[model samples]
Target chain A: MAIEHSSVDLSDAMILEPTALADWIITAPVIIPLIAGALLLMIRHETRFHAGIAIGALLLALLGHIGLLARVLETGPLTMTMGRWLPPFGISFTADVLGASMGLAATLSALVCALYSLTDIGARGRRYGFYGFLMLMMAGVNGAFITGDIFNLYVWFEVFLISSFGLLVLGSERRQLDGATKYAILNLLGTTLFLTATALLYGALGTLNMADIARVMPEVQDSIPAGTLATLFFFAFAMKAAAFPVNFWLPASYHTPRIAAAALFGGVLTKIGVYALLRTFGMLMPDQLTLLSTLIAWVAAATMIIGVMGALAQTDLRRILGFVVISGVGTMMAGLALGSVEGFSGAIFYAFHSILVMTALYLLAGVMNGLAGTYSLRTLSGLYTSHPLVAAFAFLLFLAVSGLPPASGLWPKVMLIRASIDGGAPWLAFAILLSSLLTMLALGRVFLLAVWRPAVEPSTAMVVSPGIGYAALLVLAVPIVWMGVYPEPFANVATKAAAGLTDTSAYIRSVFPEVVQ
Target chain B: MQTLIFRTAAPYISSLMVLFSIFVTLRGHNEPGGGFIGGLIAASAAAVYGIAYGVPAVRKALYFHPMAIAGSGLMLSALSGVFSIFHGVPLMTGVWGSFGFLGATVDIATVVTFDLGVYLVVLGSFTSIALALEEREDG
Candidate 1:
């Protein structure tokens, strides 16, 4: 794909240039999914067609996102001002390397999840509404990453939350309903806190723009009563990210959804919270971050240990994976606490890796449930015999999650550990290593029970659709290995993105040059 | 007699409430009223309609599906942010233009457009949930 750069001279009276056609790449990822979602709603009667269109839209989104990421990498950050208004007043859509890369990861995961749903859920029942909800959720996740405004982030959160509510309850089982209520209440509380934080930030600074806030923060840091507000904001994001002490709702709520839905939720949702935490701390309040870093580090350690313990106790495959997601959250945060470039890059790279590995693991679990007629560990056995492909894919993902060599997970763990050691926090490094061990143990238990054990009743077998299952597995599996093997490009981009976030000077200059005044 | 009162009072009250919601949504940018409040009002209207009439009856009267409304609202709100492009502004930048109408100056902008979108989305989502739960109970 050819990358185009456009610049309109703003040396005249206006502070910024109007948006050009080049801006389309920034907004297209959000707009396309939404348009597809609206189109799906119109054809609610045609279940298969809706599912196909939804999947196609996600595929197109994934491709388009890659193209956009290429453009951002070739150029610097790709920014499009809304309605052509300048930075302080209007909302901006930024395709920074980090945001675009996350968007790409999310879109790919959604695409695989969509495909898996078509086979798994379609076999069980017709759910056109579910497809529609899935599309909306995709739009929310994409938009949240790319948006340059805090309030816009909140809106996207609601967009995703509303659809998630629908997906969580689509099964209408009693457990699903109960879980949905708890999920709904907790998420609502989180969003409300997020909204209030936005309001408080806006009130403090008179601006809601992320770049603009970064510019203004230093002047106000001393007079603005920073610590308390910062704590509130941290708590709010931590709740959303499902950090320790606030993470109970995730495992409780996630396991009740249909496996396909649960896979997407596990893969994409918590990352948004983590993304927000990283963006806010790294960009908006870097000065105060030092104070909070210790607290955040402890949270990461606790979340990691607690998450694995929770995973070890789970008898169900989906629930166990859900808890594993919780544990991995700590690993991702460890990089941020180290507060070094290597640590930050490792954290971000690990985040990207976790998105793929977790989704693949969950997708494999969904396939297992489809084949074995149950997700219970007691009921499932010896999938290596009948479903060798599924077994192989599951084992690959298990290795990836365990941070074993030759897989994507190992590199990020290595980088994080190195960063921890360099930062003189060997204890943190040890905690990460310990967490990895527990994760290995937790996943090892699952692999043994799900893949190695002999099937108790060969007669009671559920037929797995080889075509879709293999396709879905390949979709995620390829990236897991490719990224693991050749991670330099991603690492380079992540380093630049992290630097851009930390320096804040490039972001500030981009939004407000000396000429603007 | 109570049923008669509900029958007599519900439609007018519901209609008035929806109209008020529109008012709140339109005025949201300058003042406190906006899409969220408007959506709540409209959802309340739907609930009252549900109670006065049967849930099925209310759902039938809602010609547009709730989810569709919510989805469209989301699109509209997002589009409002994009609208800033026309005036050479960034996304979600507020733009205002005024025209004289009916011996008064009338102003319109993307923020109001966004609020209107929010109204539709909130109304659609809340009402859909209410209607779904009502249907479940009926069954």
Candidate 2:
């Protein structure tokens, strides 16, 4: 059945597109955090109370996003035009099921990260500014997912970057400074490339909106250099996503911060890059994407293997989790490369699942390190006996992250495997399975060294922080089971989100009306 | 050698430049001036202050930490987006209304809010880097 929709026709006549309150609701996911972030900056002096405000803002944003998700599910994709300017003249915000769902997930993750930071950050330093930066990062991630304008995506990237720099260096320790410098320099380079690509795309398409570019891209094949522009966009996203060769920046830079900061970066930052990749290639430049998908698949395979290998080599607890998170990026991108509905769905599902699982794992690692004194495997032991509750939660998160049964990670892997087999890429499926097994092995190693090994010298005792870390752990832990046990609801949302992404026509119709021949 | 570099650049040069940075941010939307450039300029101004004056002097002169300013800028920019919802528009959408500016109508758009957000973000971010580097130098 054809979806009944209304849109403005600016090509010939200036007709107002029929819109709804739902449009406003869909945009709330981004709006709430943005507002909260602004409110947060005003009262930075109340250092003691800033956590409350930050957590409150995150909770409100989560609620607002949940409300938006409900409306989008009841309806279809929701679209809003900025400044009442007609499409092609003004920017648009589109909340397809995927964008809103991912947005909600991002907000929820940020909220937990904020809670986690309360204890994690306070112990390391007293930087009240981190909360505002966290809020800004959330705003950037949410904006990137929902934005239908290409240039706005770049703006959102900057937002995420600026805040990220603060969070990375919040402690101002020697290691943090070094890591932040590297992180900042690499990300700045990525931003430059991204801006160049954006300028080139605008020059090629004459419009900066994604939907407009998609509509005009096919027509300009003969006149413009689509291949060159597509490559530019692809390379920029690859660097941002940390795919293979460009992936070094992530593991090198991410390990320097406190657990809460690391958790947020692990969960949200890279995903923004992944989201851009999926949106731009899957929607805007579909034909050119097919040509590049094979190369991306190889890169995905390499990233997976290398990331897992890197994880195995790490002695630091946060570093291991960091590598695992990087490896998972490959799995997500692999599904995107497959270019099948099931593959895309699996990719999006994996992304949703990984954010929860990885964030929880990092928090759990933080808890262990807090209790055990040091994050080094050689330094930690008997965590299971001393902190069984933490062990159980970490174990569950481990199983979930490793794609083991009774958790959400399994289903996405299953879907990805099936998609690969159906596409006749048995080697790709083999690679994914091998990576999953290796991921399981890597985490198992962490579990062994961290939980099962004999207790070390009695002088080094684990001191668990009260209130903040435990509270954050509880907040993140609940969803790992909820999403795993009853995956249908979120899975449905993800499928809808994936479908919205794959169907460029629907996106076009939402942004611009069909020009009369 | 380092002190020589500091002595070469005038002490007021940085503060004067910072004032110009604020000007760029304030007038961003209509002209080429916007938050990113303005923030960068402000940051450079602070960096100059750091070199000409001692790091501690620069820090004391600012009164607030560089990171705090960045945080405040981020908040301001984000507030601009949030304020649009009261007018029944989407987040980050430019909402235009006219107000009397000395008997002349002035357009207040949401883009201005966004620009302000950008301004704060750039200002806060760059200053933090500058301050962090200064602290490293002292150590």
Fraction of native contacts (fnat) of each candidate: 0.48, 0.38
* DockQ, prediction 2: 0.27
Q: For residues A1-517, could you state the per-residue lDDT of candidate 1 as single tens digits?
A: 0001116443343444455656577877887788788767655666768877887888788878988889877876776655445567757776777788888998988898888886767623344488888888898999999988889889999989988998898868999999999999999999999898888888888998888888889899898867776787888888888889999899889989877788889988988888888888878887777878899899999998899999999999988998999988888888877777788888888888888888888888878877888888987888889778887887788889989866789888988999999998999999999988998999899889888888877737557666776788898888788777987877887787788778776566655655232
Candidate 1: TM of chain A?
0.95
Rate residue B95 of model 1 by lDDT. 73
Docking class of 2: acceptable
| CAPRI classification of candidate 1 | acceptable
Q: Write the residue-wise lDDT of candidate 2 on A1-517 in tens digits.
A: 0011125433342224434554576666666666666666666666777788778877887887787778777766567877556777667887777777788887888888887776776622544467767877888888888888889889999988988988888867899899988889998999899899889887777898888887788798668887787788878888888888798888888888878888888887787788888888877777777888898789889988899999999898888887898899999889888877778888889989888777878888788878878888887888788778877877888888888877778888888999999987788898899999999899999889888887876535648664577677777767777777888876787777778777777777777666422
Work out the TM-score per prediction. 0.88, 0.86
Candidate 2 lands at a TM-score of: 0.86
Model 1 local distance difference test score: 0.82
Q: lDDT of candidate 2? A: 0.78
In model 1, state the lDDT of residue A229.
69
